[model samples]
Target: TAFAGVDPGVNESGSYAPKSVPTSKRGSSNLRKTLFQAMDVLIKTMPQDDPVYQFMDRKRTQGKPYYVYMTAGANKFLRIYYGRVKEYLSVLPDPS
Candidate 1:
């Protein structure tokens, strides 16, 4: 999604239906690049039992290209990060 910027795009017809995955131009390219590099490092250093690496390995075994695997991993990382951060924030004491 927004993390990797690969959210699906609406068709040219402008209906609600999405037709293809398109990179959104709104986010910081540097952050995307950092996520990609992090993904590469994770694949190299993480244990095989790690869920993220397992997902990447499954995609690799399925004949997906390197970029595809990395991008998917980055997206997964972002989704996890979002969920964890949201939970952490919700537990904070109210300032009011």
Candidate 2:
């Protein structure tokens, strides 16, 4: 998540904390842009069965802002991607 810069940013001073937090966006800009684009497509398609779409839709229904839902969807997408990749790699034969 942080690697993709979609992770939430930390904002604190002394004992104070803001009510709203934004993304860290410390990773590659191009990668973030690509993820946002993918999210837009998912929203346009409105795939009810897709978990990412479902998550974003829920956020939207909750009155969350556009970027908020989009970022959340992107984060969810990356998490799913990581899980599938890990599972696939776990089944690979040893190089040796």
What are the per-model numbers of colliding residue pairs?
0, 0
- Candidate 1, after superposition: displacement of residue 30 in Å? 0.3
Q: Give the alpha carbon lDDT tens digit for every residue of 1-96 in model 2.
A: 888898999999999989989899999889999999999999999999999999999999999999999999999999999999999999999999
**Cand. 1 TM to true fold:** 0.77
List the lowest-lDDT window of 10 residues for candidate 2.
Answer: 1-10
Candidate 1 per-residue lDDT over residues 1-96, each given as its tens digit:
664564444446545555445556356678888888888888889787667788888889999888778878877778888899999999999999
Clashing pairs in 1: none
lDDT of 2: 0.94
Each model's Cα RMSD: 3.0, 0.8
Residue 29 of model 1 has an lDDT of 78
What TM-score goes with each of the models? 0.77, 0.96
